[model samples]
Target: MEVEKMLHMKGGNEDTSYSKNSLLQRKVISMTECIIKEAITDIYCATNCPKTIVMADLGCSSGPNTLLVSNAFINIINEISLKMGHESLEIQIYLNDLPGNDFNTIFLSLPKFVKNLRKDLCMSNPSPPSCYFNGLPGSFYKRLFPSKSIHFVHSSYSLMWLSQVPHIQETNKGNIYMSTTSPPSVIKAYHQQFKSDFSMFLKCRANEIVSGGRMVLTILGRRNEDPCSKECCYIWELLAMALNDMVIEGLIEEKKMDSFNIPQYTPCSKEVKDEVEKEGSFTINCLEVSEVNWDANTDNRLNLPDKNGGYNVAKCMRAVAEPLLASHFGESIIEEVFIRYRKIITERMSKEKTQFINVTVSMTRKA
Candidate 1:
């Protein structure tokens, strides 16, 4: 454990994973939240807000993903309102995330989206539901919504990352990842952190989810006995190796690298079970964890250094690998890194389609 700490102290990139709401993202997240829609359909029938109701998408990143969320909510609301014979009551939606999120980008795109959507509904000869959209900012782990004030909440992909890093220099004595070199200790520290963070999330959420409110969460996860192995995804391990080789070449020092960490969040099932079971305020409606196939079309574009691809693969991960690369690679080297990253990831995928897993939990608040 101590040896690992010294190596991390030498400097390296701590994180370099990209998150774009891709086709794969849609399949995984939507599947995860499908159950939440079922519960919310009933709730929406009971109270069309203005009479009493609202919904929120926590950590809603700026992009088509936001639209995906909104559309899903719309379908649920439409169905419920139609059933209750109260289609005129406007449903207000709050798109929320940390203030650092690109919410402006999301909002900027929304007006056109609404117009287009209205046009579509008109063509179908259906009365379009009325609604209002607003952006709210806050760390969901802290205070997200007012006390007992939300009817439904949805957050995807974002819950797996903590609001900030949670490791100490001393006890963080292992593989730039684990708190200790021993597999058990590393897993323990990770579980401990997950237990704390998730419980905090539940407590805050408890305040927001009215007596019978609902929530849907989708998180990155893994399967297999060696789920924690560095090689779970060759692309990630290769990136680390590429950066590690640079360290040996005297390109970057180690201390600058270890300074960053992958903000801790529950990585697997055990920790999630611990927190949710302990909270007892939510009833799990669905818990499905499986690997999603990752076969992005890198055929002709394998070695191509695309900018968005670079951002997706690593630039977003600058915080994780800041110690490893910043001193040596130019900020502009994002392209070069993409060149190498693309080559390796494509090779791995072509060899055998790589798969990444997600753990989804759809729960309803206890009344």
Candidate 2:
């Protein structure tokens, strides 16, 4: 499948859009604030306190989280300026995503976003940096900036997506991602694909990032080496179960289910470290894992699908995965699939606690 064209979060500021359902992503971003601050501090010192700092946030999907990275930089840099008794710096930010991403929504929100950002900065520092925003639409797997230009880079909840689905020799029946039932070859294929894509990402960024520049990335990941571990793959497994039920009920074709697979991977920490070492362009600074509840950002945690918790989880997943499903399975079953998914999540969460394992890695460009 053409993932670049088909892979995008549900757009706009609607009830089910990514803008409304991205609190989980916001939480993930917040979790990395310290790492981001450290990286920025190091970059500032290493680059001799650059006056013009160019940064990019890859896979910057639309919504409030879209500008969160820039805001963090502005605040952190201003703090650094005060500590070092240096003048305010100029900040240039490039917001990047796939061509199909909702850049329009982000652009439309920019006027108010900047005004609020500046107002907040004024309270902290009278002379805040002059920040500029640019929307660049492209795949991060390839070059997106001039060589040795960007001073910092940040991406959250995005690297797990492969450039495209792995080409397996056999059909991964009854599953859309690596699962316990998947054959050994299926897991190997996914690992190889992730290695290739991640290596390319590092290599591309190596060219784009100046020496001493830093990058911080957050990905859906697993603590265990097992590809089929619940931490990483259970959500998709539940989604596949919903699809299988629809197939049995004549709502969707079994053939379609058998043919489809997600172009994503949840790597273990070892996998990430290995890929970075193999790529030979960046040095891993820190790698840590955190867990987020499936039913986060809501108080109705005890209730299942019948209440708000499970329903909210389902909506969040839909906001992120609906476009991929619509492109491959047809948009007709989107609503029904999520309805079943919500119930499954509620039942499972009631019996057992399931959470998304997020792997956050901070790295510096090799000199």
Candidate 3:
């Protein structure tokens, strides 16, 4: 299959499956899984269309969580396939990400996952999900899938980040993304990037998604009407503080700071809904707001033992924030920064365990 070659290319990686507890990751798969089942079943029931279904998961990173999502998708597709009496229907699944994702983990885990799925299929009383899986490697901003080849497209937390780092020119010696801190220009720039990337995704998928393909996008976003709310993301706040501390210490010059933009942007759901509706390429099926308490909780099991101590406040943030903090703040500072962040998250969660989590927006292409 050419998709296999696609996986081995410069920006290739094995498909990372995600688990339900992964908050944003699991939710993205869940949203996609729902829409795919609905789209396939509806088309088959109404028009008795051919059952060749192509599905793609964007920004699937390496880990057990990736496989978990894959398994759920396969199950759903297989159930739909059986109901439609299309045992031989093609369910081509694609795992897409940037060039440097951890493909080794995906490659190593696939055999075991497939074997387990087959075993479960044989033993289960119910029919299995009908689908074939492939790892399609590349930036989602570019054309990865063939024209009109995809039936469903899924991405989580990924779309919030730009395909490449946004160029930030130092104006008046301030970081572009951070200096504004939810200023009109900052939000506008982020919204623009999202519109561009998402619009491109629709254009590429328009040809591939048959007449009624579905796309589900889940991302970290703000609940407050104001994008600049401090509570929106304590992670960003902690980083800002860390950077400020650095500046105070004379570790890095203020003039060179703008280059350190967090290659990511989290726009509000309302902003996203307006943009998709305005694009007119697709119809909005639903926009859901869920809490994403990535911060730690107070479950002091023997193993976890409140691992971060009172830092449970910073619960689930360690995954994404760790890399950036490590990179800019230095390996030595990550532990310190996280310690402080956790202290804040722990206290914050005590009052409210979950901040409005990621929002999953589902849309179907217009015929």
lDDT of 2 at 341: 97
TM-score of 2: 0.96
- What does candidate 1's lDDT look like per residue over 208-278, in tens digits? 78877778887876554343543243444556555555556665456544443445443666556657989
Q: Pick the candidate with the highest lDDT.
A: 2
lDDT of each: 0.60, 0.90, 0.58
In TM-score terms, candidate 3 sits at 0.78
Each candidate structure's TM-score, on Cα atoms with residue i matched to residue i, is 0.78, 0.96, 0.78
- The residue ranges of model 2 lying beyond 4 angstroms of the native Cα positions read 298-307
Candidate 3 per-residue lDDT, tens place, 1-367, comes to 1221222211222121122124445544554556555654554444354566666788887665556555655666566556556665555678877665667667777888888887776564254445567776677777786676766776767777765444433241334243344445555565566678767766676666656777777877776656555445555665565555566677655654544556566667887887777677888887877653343233323223344434433434555545454555456665655565565655654554344357678778788
TM-score of model 1 relative to the true fold? 0.78
Clashes of 2: 0
**Top candidate by TM-score:** 2
